[model samples]
Target: MSLPPQANSTRKALVLFSGGQDSTACLAWALERYAQVETIGFDYGQRHRIELDCRQTVRRELAAQFPAWGAKLGDDHVLDLALLGQISDTALTESRAIEMQANGLPNTFVPGRNLLFLSFAATLAYRRGASVLVGGMCETDYSGYPDCRDNTLKALQVALSLGLDQSMTIETPLMFITKAQTWALTEQLGGAALNELVIEHTHTCYLGERQQRHAWGYGCGSCPACELRAQGYEGFLAQQRAGA
Candidate 1:
């Protein structure tokens, strides 16, 4: 969807940043449009907890490389949602094989993950005076996580607004866009420099493997997240070449 009016700089935004590719792009998108932007992450004891570290690098690089966005960037909050990990037995939170479940969903699917994430993000936003909540929960290129669906987030938006008695807007800029489009969006938001920054800094491996780096970024190259990123990067290059 088109971004909220660029003129609305008076509004503050809170992004649900997981230090992953999509969330990193969402952060850039928020930085480009919002006057003030803050980021929130959940430390739910996932196997790839390295993403938590990568987020800090992404933030620092963004501030150092883009002064304008850096000025707009605000506080970073990391919530200890260890309860989520305790409750979830998925491949992400546990040491298990990444495979499909009999129910048709992947083992990586964490139940109520996005739901809990948005709820907590909204709570934080309410306290931070940020009316706009931005997330990278995309339906276009995802692992069929029900919580990532647009309708799920839309419903939660209404519930959050009603529960808080405030008009809260959940903005998913990447909801309808493909992963390749997400790469293009990063370039559009902050140019080639931002694209490179995201590529080098963001972490998408479910296994938390950073020892090996690829043309797309760092990952095990076998997990679903890594494969999606690799294919998307190739598609992004193809788009650039075709345009050239």
Candidate 2:
């Protein structure tokens, strides 16, 4: 199906989804601006298998709203980056240490995760006949991961254009937007009403432990991941209470 047009006709977008806050927010963001939107996620074999499960759940959530949202995010593509996970012994894979910051870069940095995710998304865009790829990489309020930088996205865009026959665009809707702003965006896109998704469906726990989640998510509440989600939700809740 075709996506709706905002101001510049129809924009095609491919969302790199993790079924988490940022990606889910970006999915909603892309739907408003693009004519067609597709989502791609990775199964890097992180210790948190719950994340994969949540991703599927989030996909189903979006699928249920496909027609209502008026944008098409086709089937969820799960790529086996298990090898990448094996080599990644940092916080993202096997680090025993807890995150130091509440909402900044942590030890869980995967060297080339976003790189691989975007590469695969670009390839899928080519096959699926899309012209844009959207992701939820926030530099303003993230753990300071290098991959979330603007330059990284630009570099990937260049690399993909050079490596592939078809030219595709990568859209980082949440690049500059803070996590708080992301929460606002999700609410603006009508996702906040789906409070269950905001809480249960998305996997934000770096440890990947479902038993660890609170009303917010699988966050340790002290770790950077949990802290950020908490902080952002605080902003979201406050705004919701204030009515814009």
Q: Among these predicted structures, which one has the highest lDDT?
A: 1
Model 2 per-residue lDDT at 81: 82
lDDT (tens digit, per residue) of candidate 2 on 22-70: 8887777777777677677788877665677787777777667556554
Cα-based lDDT for every prediction = 0.93, 0.75
TM-score of 1: 0.97
True-structure lDDT of candidate 1? 0.93
Model 1 per-residue lDDT tens digits across residues 132-176: 999998899988889999999999999999999999999999999
TM-scores, all candidates, are: 0.97, 0.86
